[model samples]
Target: MAYEVLVQSVVDYAIYLLDREGRVSSWNPGAERIKGYSPGEILGKHFSRFYTEEDRHADVPEAALGPSLGGDIQFETAVP
Candidate 1:
């Protein structure tokens, strides 16, 4: 629970929750900062909004979620 709260307080990385149906069930300050959307503006919206228009239209957002939820996705960050 405390971890959840800490994540909620973040202002980076666009943290969010997607239900089984792939709908956004929650939004956090980080989401607002990275996505330019406030919680009130984006809650209940599909998590695909973070993708480019072409990606969304091609369902690439769904594809990304699949591996992520399956624990087969890995993210690497490099600092320049």
Candidate 2:
């Protein structure tokens, strides 16, 4: 499908979707490359994995999702 094409072809941006509970629902090739997680390994996992340990300890994941409940959040970061 065309949706699949655009999402999967991205290479510089980590493109993916999260469920209501912040679990990865869909993953793209760029997400795999940038975050080091293949869909098989990361799907259904919490987005907390992308946070630093200190951030996790600070409950940053939950806080980060609060403002974006009904919208999109965009920021640029280098992931590896």
Taken over the whole model, the C-alpha lDDT of each candidate is 0.74, 0.84
List clash counts for every candidate, in order.
0, 0
Candidate of highest lDDT: 2
lDDT of 1 by residue, 1-80 (tens): 99788988788677888887677888888778877888788878887776767766776677767775774544332222
Clashing pairs in 2: none
**Ten contiguous residues minimizing lDDT sum, candidate 1:** 71-80
Error of 2 at 47 (Å): 0.4
Question: TM-score of the candidate numbered 2?
Answer: 0.81
Query: What's the distance in Å from true for residue 3, model 1?
Result: 3.0
In model 2, the runs with Cα more than 4 Å from the true position are 70-80
CA RMSD of all predictions: 4.6, 3.5
Residue 13, candidate 2: Cα error in Å is 1.5
